[model samples]
Target: MNQDSKNKERHQGRSFTNETLFLKDLVGFQRIKYRYVNVLGMLAGLLIVVQAWALSNLFAGLVSFNTLSFFMLILGLLAWLLRSVLHLIRDLIASEASRNIRFNLRKKLLSELTFLGPKRSVIDEDAALSTRVYEQVDALDDYYSRYKPQTFMVTVVPFIILLTVLPISLITFFIFLLTAPLVIFFMVLVGHKAANANRKQFSVLAMLSNQFMDMNQGLSELRRLSRVKDARERLSSSAKAYQSTSMGVLRLAFLSTATLELFASLSIAMVALYLGLGLLEKLPWQLGSSPVTLTNAFFLLLLAPEFYLPLRQLGQDYHAKQKAEAAASGILQILEASTSDSSTTQVHLKDSETPQTLMLFDSLSLDANKRTRLVSISGHIHEGERIWLSGESGVGKSSLLYILLGFEDSYRGQCLIDGIDIKQADLSQWRSRLAWIPQSPEWINGTIRQNLTLGLSNLDSASIHDALEKSKANIFIKKLPNGLDTKLSELGTGLSGGQMQRLSIARALLSNADVWLLDEPCASLDQETAEAVLETINRVSEQKTLLVVSHDTHPIEWVDKHWKLTKEGLYEVA
Candidate 1:
């Protein structure tokens, strides 16, 4: 894309101020890690000047064949060793702090996503969340552990060096003062532009990730439709876009580094030229007495590079700061979202006590896109009621299911369990009284027993066997070599539609919950499998309050109440 187009895409309502605040909140002011790192860095800075002084004096003594040359050389080496050890220890401490910070930040982000739930959160794209949680948060590692501490040294270390040099040569000190601010001014200017570029780069990365995830998820569909080439082209386009954006960011980072290097080199050269001229007593103009000794000249030259070292380090980590800030933008959006009402009363329901009345009074819900799905809806189901709710695909059947699951609260009215608004009841307590079997049941790469029990420690083998038998899964499961111990692939890859459906039913039965919410239990199954699943539902409904959503209108023996949802409203049907 052209610069203008890229800039427009990047400026899509992003507030740099808000992003800055997000980063500040993430790092915070009272960081104990920062404090420790700063103290060690300042001590290291002090030792740096000491080592420089020793080395300069050693050089002068050696030139004069002085006896103290060896002692000065030893002192320099010792100071150098101590400085190296301190830096190593400081880095270790900073690394540990970075690890802890990343861990805590990821945990906090995940908690926010959980509180937002799938309904409120953007969950369709797996890569979006992964990029924010992993890559974006990781970018902060250098900023916290390296860049930030170096930033402090950039300010304090140079001043300390200036103090040491002032008594030896005021001219060298004045030259240092004049050139240092120019490097900073250029670095700050370049760094500001680099931050914007980095933000754009991270945004592109997220887009690329989402695109790749979509391509992966829909590859089968694309191949079946003979549109794989189209999909590939789209993915390639996204990849190219990301590459271009990344190159732009890298170019800016390189430019900033080069700028800092150029200014630092020039500045050091200027100081060196002045010191050399003064030592030779060859300056065209004189401001003060030339107190330039070989030792003083060497000391000033040695400290010049040290003065610019932190600024160079800061420039190197400048991009890291920008990337972290960009990542913080996404993280903070989730963190700052208004949480759902967590108000809950002491009212609790027994696991096996089938709800006497589950009612929705004037309840409504809007989908994630903020489109009205259900409007002024009202309904009731009594204990032991077998209800089948049907609707056209977009008529809000799933929205209602989400509401009853306590996953969506974009609705306006009330949902009550036994006359108490479920909103007022402890959601965890209320959810425990129910079991849900989605159209696509999830399974881990484990044995059938693990999938069925789902880590419920209290569920014994006898109970599992009984549940499986009731769901008709026991017959097929027993034939396997290890029966319940038979391992399956992710999503139960070896199982047929009928087997997976039966497994879901078995899991629900094992819960022994008062109510069962089955969403399209017979979907995508062959006629025989569908009949078997319907039969399992028929058997389960007799003992529990069953709410099923199915497109198949063919009457079933188990259904005691029937309802249809529409854009107008929800109502009972014949």
Candidate 2:
């Protein structure tokens, strides 16, 4: 008896909440909100009557041989029909409620995630994140729609069965009541241990799946390092761990199943034992010969075994609950992280034109890593002037470009644009108003035209070609088989380093922003080509607010002002 009670306590309290995991635990959430759960509760109460009526009549042999038996069956069909329709309706409502709950919760979690992204939560490998979002979260659908309602049905069914039986026969009723707690006791105790095992297996599976996804993403890197065989071995180990744990769960589950059946059979056999003796006149009442009259004992006999059927099911569902618990814990961690970040700091972006200014530093410092710092910094430029920042080797020249680009996390003072703070404004919108082309900008698999027309509608292709012609990019595109529409493969097979840079400049020129932040605008070019590119930069910077971070010491001399970054700080040199 104590053992039965112990099992009951194991599944007593499993919680799933927090914005992330809440969506995954929709099954539990729906039961709490089910307005019709009470109505379903009443149906569960009526089920005892339905079972008694159906089983009693079936045993009574009211439908004797031939047409006489058939007549009795047709006449008694109404009672069976009531039972069928009620169960059907109850099941349908539970299914619908579960579906609604799961969908709404999933949608809510996704929306919250959107509000906190790009920097809030990063997916190192998006494939795993996406799989968890769709697949792992999908594991809850059946649980919500089926197992959740079943949980309630399981809880209410046994007691209702006991309640109906007690009035008809207290002796048999107390016995049913007494042994049920014992079976349930074993179920809870063993089921708790099984749930824990299932939890561990599920975690390992999710981890394994995520790791394999990452392995696939970095397949190229792995291949280069000749580590593909090692990666596969690791995956195999994870799979084995999952399988071993799952088998352990299955073993516990079989024990649970056998235990539920054992106690249930024992209880029903007692009822049968009691009734079999009653036939020999052990009790005061005599056994009826009429099918309906004697049918009572038969239905009672059938119901004994039926009462434990769901409890038998408890083992498998306890595992499902275990899976839900695992998924819930993982998702909750994500929600807590997002919530904490949101509560701790209100992130106002860098483009809001607040009182704080967003001007360029006189000189910005740079270095590769540890030894990198400011060496040459020159003074500021007004709204319309085009300034060029230049320096020698190992200088903080490129670092100056990062400072203006807003990638650097730390800077000595504020950069103000017209007395407005750069940090508060939308950097995206601000970037939209300017063109930036780094020395070696990355490219995707696309044509030169696609790179230029990216995110822009109604762009003039003629202007695109003109910008390309200026950067000498048009020369390479024209040489391709498809000309401007050539498909650049993933690894950039068709274009040279110089050609890629030229296309980047063309993209920048197409943007036509107020300010052009050009870092090493004419790098990695032959002497003659570098001269032409510099000529184009001088022409383009005339009306634009250009801040050129360059390593060139050419003769043209068109820079209106020069800022040098030194150890002292940024100051104007020309």
Candidate 3:
């Protein structure tokens, strides 16, 4: 079998780690917050017994028509109220804990993503990664809040109820004990199936989400190529698969609930029958020394259902166990993908300390998707040099940039900075000394000043205005009512394409990096705007090293070197 098929088989098999143990490992149960949540839950379970005992006494008093019946009823109501309060507190604690855990998981996931950089190629689609990181991580809420604490309750609560029942009648206690295992056994059997189904369901959900995002993004291109129908059909297929798997999961959950209900009802009924017989003195032989009093009978009857309540709840939450397991599987998979391979050696450095001097790319090569994109490419990018690199659309221009940023590890040959191997340098420190401007710049929904000065702190207005002016972005900023303080929608939607590019250029310039990398900097802009941006870039390149990757042949009088990347290698242009 192929690797993917084997992976699927393993994922669907009955080989998962213990769900509770996995959660505990991720966020230790020894944490003070989680301990508080569990303690509250345990207290709530103990309250069930108090509530049931009070209700039983009230019932017995009403049957006897005693004057104390009113007081007993009031006590029962108070016990019920206290139980509700405990439950509410436990729920609030669980919610707070779940929120904290989700926050931590998201932070950890983002850190790993930053470490892996942009070229990890694990999920291939941003939508799929987002779904896993956002939705799948959030799905862990019920597992930690409900399923985990519930598991503890299932273990402790029933035994506590059993202790209360044993003193009244050992016969009733034994009957409860014998039938309890049947409910749990069936639950485990069905839960195993539910877990497998949930794993496949989540996989399909991710697949469908990725397809929908890709279709939406490439709709224009698909329509232009007359393949819109094909794209739509594939998306529909994935969506249908996800829907079918989801329904199957629901059916299993319902079936498990029904089966547990049947077993628990039977167990309760058996206990009730035994208690009633003992009260009527209908048993052939004695099971306990004390006769079954009216008070004891009612208590046992009330406590029987309470004994099974925790188990019943656990059965209901079996689906959550499955969901959490599936989410954990996806999360662990991403974490494993972030592990550094042997090909790249990481060296630690003090913050912001980067190597200086010209970087040499010697006999560099990379193969992706069975196609050789770069072959024996060799070149030098000296400090304080203005270089323009031109390449055809599919000649791996962006891939080379990724290499310099230490984002792509699956490549051969040496990238040297000051005669030290790039692999041995600290990537974070190296990145801190470089600035990148992509073909499409990303913008958050924030003020223009916030977008420009994202990573840096404490920039005076004069410096901000200076960078903006140099990039030619001040032209439009002056027209705006708020200028630098103006709020922008996502991706700077209110701004023209050229305006956004200039703002990105301004942001890059503000970084004050020694080396600047530009990927198709003026792509999709008008000739006038492109020329203006190029002129700004040319003026900035006088001091800093510049690596400009573009298809534009606009004259750059300030550039010192020019190269064109072809199938064989990079060639210096005459």
Q: In candidate 1, where is summed lDDT lowest over 10 consecutive residues?
A: 6-15
Residue range 1-574, candidate 2, lDDT tens digits: 2322322322222234442345444445565545475466457556656756665665577433222345435434654576567667766776777667656656655644543333222432344455455555665655655566566667777777887777677777888778878877887887778767866765777777778776775677899999999998988998898899889978887877787778778887888887666645565454542212256677677677667766666645655665565565555544443321111222233433333323645333444346756553535566557777766755666655555554442444555444444433344455677777776565667876676788777787688877887767777788888988888754456576567667777777787776788777667677776677777677655766778887655534787777754455655665
498-520 per-residue lDDT for model 3 (tens digits): 89988988888888887899889
Model 1: per-residue Cα lDDT over 83-192, one tens digit each = 89989988988888788888878887675565445453444355777788888889888877887778888999999998998888788888888988888788878888
- What is the lDDT for 169 in model 1? 78
> How many clashes show up per model?
0, 41, 0
TM-score of each predicted structure versus truth:
0.85, 0.62, 0.78
Model 1: residue 551 alpha-carbon error in angstroms: 3.3
What is the lDDT of every predicted structure here?
0.77, 0.62, 0.78
Measured with C-alpha atoms, the lDDT of residue 8 in candidate 3 is 39
> Could you give the candidate ranking by lDDT, starting with the highest?
3, 1, 2
* Candidate 1 accuracy as TM-score: 0.85
Q: Which candidate should be chosen as best, given lDDT against the real structure?
A: 3
